[model samples]
Target: MSWRPQYRSSKFRHVYGKAATKENCFDGVPITRGVQDNNFCAVNPRFLAVVTECAGGGAFLVLSVHHTGKVDPHHPRVSGHRGNVLDVKWNPFDDYCIASCSEDATVKVWEIPPHGLLKNMTVALKELQGHSRRVGLIEWHPTAKNILFSTAYDYKVMIWNLDCPEQVIKNPVRTISHHTDVVLSMSFNVDASLMATTCKDRKIRLLEPRSGTLLQEANCKTHKASKVLILDNVNKLLTSGTSRWNDRQIALWDLDDLSVPLLEENLDGSSGFLFPFYDPDTHMLYLAGKGDGNIRYYEISSEKPYIHYLTEYRSNLPQKGMGVMPKRGLDVSSCEVFRFYKLVTIKALIEPLSMIVPRRSESYQEDIYPMTAGNKAALTADEWLTGIDRGPVLMSLKPGHPTGESDGECEKDQAYIRDRLIAKNGGKTDSNGVAGNGGTTVSNGQDFLLCSPPKTENELRVKFYKQQDEIRRLVDLLHQRDVRIKQLELEINNMKNSQQNSLEHF
Candidate 1:
């Protein structure tokens, strides 16, 4: 059979256009079917790694081999975890060594080859285990490969020394358990001196990596929040996310005094649970919401906050979500675009020879001249007929024709048969009226067709009306709830006043 067209839709063509039409194509190469279930991705100075949760309960790492856009099929495959691998990072100075943390309560160090191998190119160099529960995050020390940090559900963060890979240290160098809930995210400042952890308790804490001393704490009231905390070179801290009261806000904090925010501004719309990204180079913040399916960009400045849309790309599927917007690569000479494709299930034929019939018994009787028949051979006649020596068959199937047929005669015969078949099939012609193999084309001279626009202005008007109605209904409900809350508070105050008068009388 001919190759089935897997991608022929207009959308695919629009995304990946002809090589000549660079403007029509996406900003960069589209990475189809690269990411697994994991939503987190990271890129170092040289390599790009996509960390995905595997189907077998572990994580799969697909890395780009070089700084360029080439992917090596034999990159690496580090396995040996019982849970999802949440995070993976390579040492800034050494690209060959990588650290991965898993929900299996273990962290592993892997030394990957720079090129291909006969076997799997990736191998785990060492495994570190200390957390009692699933590890949430893993980050390498900014300055040294000898140290790494990991936080887990066990309510403690651990630091490890890679100098001794075989031994398991029971106690971490420093442990922070101040958060009342699970630590969902963590990051280290550019200078490895300070580490920040955001927990489910709606608090962001800054701690010294060496001493585990809490330098400062800021309360971010958002429930189920993932905080992106950045420490500027001058020691100023910038934190942004949803508030605990369901307010969408980005707050700036002075590390010296964390009790009061230096600046706070509410975002006009709610940002769904996906974590926001902060670009230090451009001083721009990007936030995406799970419900709206839009990414909003904001500029950071000393004056009043300014936010605008850079561009919006729609998600292809529902429920399936986008992960953190990872830095495509270190080179920013041109804007890069990366597309993700989820896995698809496929069915295939396993057995190919189940329908063939055996040769007739008359042929089997002729074979009795050289083979024993009344001697009762254990092998059946059909098996014997089918079991001709494979060497001769393979040789006969090779190019240049079997020993019995001449090459010239075979070629002539094949041409004659093909012409006869074509004639019998009426010399099937395509839309161009050329007598050739079957193919379809548009009836018109045009090579392609444009998509039809929306039906009518009335339909568009209705859609807009429906959206406005939804917004109005939501506002009315919120106002009613607020009024009820105020009435309840007034009644409770009146009751307290009456109780106080009775106590005074007594």
Candidate 2:
């Protein structure tokens, strides 16, 4: 028989996505039915944020990632936007901080309570309102601490430095005016030194993110309705778009030379937009269509035919939007390398799919899960503004639930919390917030440490008691206030009755 070349060998070839069971899925979530091109979901290790439909104004629901099953209809929400929310992105360095853009022509940054939301939040930490038109997309900087990028219907890209310590920010730090039509998608390179965007004008352009300088514009004319993300590992740019024949296509181009694409492949003639996500550690690229149930993955290599097609994960429910859990948030014990939170609008459910590498050994698989990008940021907003570039901080997956934060960082956070609690209580505090012991250990049910989870039963009891005491005190105060108000109203009514009697006698 004539020699036939075989497919390339890859460890990730056998990796498959294992979806969660029905009981573990989020249910009764009123997902937004808006036709916006952007995904209405954003997730991190702490919380899952979903854009929900409400009557009076725009609102989105935030649930603890650990809390699955049925969500209460009266659950707390962040409903500050006056219009439909277009996109939501969590801060890489801070798990409790999230940024959202809305059709109200403003971008708002909200800080969720560390444990989770307890009541409806109607205010935001900062509000940026420079866009004359509705803001459609918002993305956080990969390496910097407080850098955010947003695009609006006004054909302008705006950058905001959220490091303001005194007051809320009203305008973006810089704005890039390049596209003639609407800007469809925007992405930053590895260290966020450069940016790539696909505009509605059917063109791809590369630019300097910090300075708002246009670097290069791709001249391809056939691919339209595109979304772009850079594979910084291979120094290549990938774009998913539609051909003139209405066929979906994916193209890979070199970063240095965007004059032409390095490779292009036509996908099926699906009308939905293709959202591309790349995991650098696994060298895997996943494309999930907007209105489809299939998630196609490929292996990107450095050799010829760089983009290698792998098997796809198929389902029956079409997804409205999707959110990816951070690499550090993955379940390393289950050999779970990647996780996607898929939003199924028809059922109003959020199902999680875990991409697993089938390994016989129960021990940690070091090869497959290397030191991936950690949750800690590499540079601050000031450092990035001063032209300093750094890659993402690296962390070992050996720690099953590594928070990607250094011990010193975690210690600093704990110390700050203890100081704040002490100030609020007007005394030195202990771990249980009582005025006693010398050593202070601020504990919570949701441990924010960088190691494996510890026993939280005691912490939960302590928290429950503290909350109970506060509620009791507040209730007593409310009763006293109500009694005084009743006494005043009775006095006023008696005076009115006496005055009416006097008037009748006259």
Candidate 3:
């Protein structure tokens, strides 16, 4: 039987209520300290798993999210890490299982009993210890159940197969050493075929998890470091970091190119790190920064200037840490498109912010509704470790909708110009004869070709100068041709005169 509380519990306070008539707001449960960005707080898709850490204790709580803002007295908690629990993640395939990274330089995998309750702090079922420094980030594979990845201050990324059972350091499935500096954030693509990492060295790299090989890398070219997030469409990546001048900016990059940002937006020069939350179904991106009271959102489309500014959610208090609930956990019936758990340190309160699409119609709009990824493992841990080429079943942005259809017809003159570029400079192919996108292949059987222009301004300038020199040389040759034509005409006239004089003498 499932665990349940016997006695009545006090109702949690709501910052804003319908009867109060002041504003629409609510407060979350009090936390020990502000949450960190490195997977500190995770809410599962089914609203079954909610994990958070306390400021004072090196422990975390697995809250019962079914009853908002209320914790069952009999509910179990997780308390194993020695130092601060920096990050925690709910397994995509298993709601009961969770992985956490800590300042103690260890990653632990914990599972809740099938009966649905842990009465006290417990040790992790599997302990992964390899990092010599604090492990700040932990992420689970989107498609695989037992596969986990962690990043630490040691500038290394380790892939773990929790099914191994043995807690040994020398037997990690794969150890990635591509980053020269500490990796700030990492994420797997929609299908889990490619993994991208943003490091403090101002570089973003894409790696193949199967072989732990570096597929491609892009220089952020900025001093400030931020996290990287893969778009739901799996074709692009959204990055938020400091600009060259030390200003905060968010950029949307095409995964194929990575050299030039498809879109770039500058924001306030605040020192807080900008955390990007992207909703694939709606193509909406929410930017929440540390130490800021406002959450800005934008609409991303395939059109030019791909990112369009939408609106911002503001409050009186700044947030120390923030957590975003999965799409499946959202109250879609109420037209809630996105939900955010904001941790405010001012009054030691956590607040819930819901982004709803205001609709006047009474009918349900499945198009606007978010169809979140279900809790089903496409591949097991053992299968992934053995190099299975399976990918996660990612939902489309506009599922059930037809692609490549236009409502109206336009002539060639009215259509926008499409640019297709190719690099002819010493291009080489891999063993598979794929030369583009640095020989990278997507799980969808599509090849990503690198067709972007020069990345840096210096490179663009050099190309421009070389083109100008070619034009100058071409003009000089044209002038020489004109001079040669004139000289040839004069010589022909002199030869004709000599021939006429010889005929008169005969």
Candidate 4:
């Protein structure tokens, strides 16, 4: 059969420039499929980590990110787990430090040599053991140098401080047992002060680990375990999961109220979990999954619904795993803002797909390509452990247009929110003395006002509903405790009677 384009429109062709320009060609790393889960891919600027299942056992490959145009079978690798490794994360602050969790119910921290990728399996520098079952996820704090979090099938979350003097000989610093089921996914906010976790019980919980506070918990009515992502600004949260009708869905929630999602969109019925990547610079979010050939992206805004569908990048090859490059690692010369590393297991290929905003004018878009946080570590591991109230230093996204010029595009974007308010309120001023349309505002060579509308009856009802639910939960817990106490008392009385009878007979 002759080959033809699957898409009716040629819009996908121009997404990443020419077909050859989309993919950065490199030799594929050979891996044995079916022996391990396809969720073991991670990358730093200097190295790429992939798990390989061989006849002997599963091993982790650390390959140089720079291209040599040749594949080396004898790459530097790590093999300490008896079973397959489930997840791996490169330390955000330390390039040499990498953390991996495995099916052996343990998490291990490994350090790569300064020279380059190792040619053989190397021992881990430290092993973290606490979970009774398989550990599947591990995450490093965004700003903290040595803090790490890991979750397992045992329904436990462990927070580790690696730089502690007695860490190697002791357990994690704190253990969170709030989750009633296996935690499927987790994400930390930009400043690392808050974290969100989605679990097998179809529940999502937000936490402030430093204060031991459970910020929020809401039931997610999904068919399968879901993944939660905190948006760049930390005021919004997003989750991807399958509905009861077996349809994939993405829902956006306001951090203040989790009782209802502000927006929910149903998608295809694919079974793979969606991994979301968000770019703060352009307010773009990309969702990719296993066994899928297309990537769907959205543009987030301050308007109602919050997410606007942009477009999708389609390909014929199915992906088994995917990873994304840090924003600082992108090629700013081509106006590229995000790059995704897709793992094609069947073909044993790792493809780099770069997403760029095409422009005809030959100029560097300052607003789009503004200064971002580099790969440099702000604090040493020991220093962070001893520090107090540490906050991450992230690149602030500019508020104007991508060109950073006072053009029509910039004016339109700056006025979009103000215009929406004017339309909604019929151009009337609110009680705060700010008009919906004719008010002085804050902008670059522009004036716009933002007003907080009073809460509606619907919002009040949502809070009432949440309070009632919490009361019912607490009542049920108290009843269960009472029943257990009565049973214990009865057992104690029977034991006393038996002892008295024995003494009388003697």
Using lDDT as the yardstick, the better of models 2 and 3 is 2
lDDT of 1 by residue, 1-506 (tens): 99885642221122210111222211222222322222344444223454543456565444432223332343334555677667777654344567777778888777654321213323467778788988877776654435678888788888776666365545555577777787767776654556777776778788876667888887754332466566444345666566556666666666677777766666655544544555543445555554343445544544343232343434322212232222322111112222222111121000000101123332212211111111112232233223321111111211122222224433443343344334534787446443345321122222111122236534433443443343334334555776799999999999999999999999
How many clashing pairs per prediction, in order?
4, 0, 4, 2
lDDT for 270 in candidate 4 is 79
Residue-level lDDT of model 4, residues 64-90, one tens digit each, is 565434456655478777877878899
Candidate that would win on lDDT: 2
TM-score of candidate 1 versus the correct structure, residues matched by position: 0.52
Tell me which residue pairs clash in candidate 4.
76-118, 441-448
TM-scores of all candidate predictions against the true structure: 0.52, 0.83, 0.68, 0.71
- Model 1 residue 281 CA deviation (Å) reads 2.9
Q: Give each model's whole-structure lDDT.
A: 0.48, 0.83, 0.65, 0.68
Highest TM-score against the true fold, candidate? 2
Arrange candidates by lDDT, highest first: which order? 2, 4, 3, 1
Clash pairs for candidate 1: 221-243, 221-244, 222-243, 222-244
Whichever of 1 and 2 has more lDDT, that candidate is 2
Please give the distance, in angstroms, between residue 500's alpha carbon in candidate 4 and its true position after superposition: 86
lDDT of 2 by residue, 1-506 (tens): 89997877888888898989988999999999999877789988768999999988889999878678999898889999999888899988888789999889999999886545657898899888789999999999998988999999999999898887634676788899989888989888779998999998888999998888899998677777478998888889999988879899999989999988888889898898888999999999999988998899999987678999989999998988899999877877689988999999999999999999988888878898888777788989899999999998888877534445556545554554455445545676666654344323323333322233344534433554553344334334555776799999999999999999999999
- C-alpha RMSD values across all candidates: 30.6, 6.0, 31.1, 26.3
* Candidate closer to the true structure by TM-score (higher is better), 2 or 4: 2
For candidate 2, the per-residue lDDT at 495 reads: 100
Candidate 1 ranges with C-alpha deviation above 4 Å: 1-39, 45-47, 53-55, 65-76, 116-123, 165-171, 221-225, 244-248, 266-271, 289-293, 302-329, 335-506
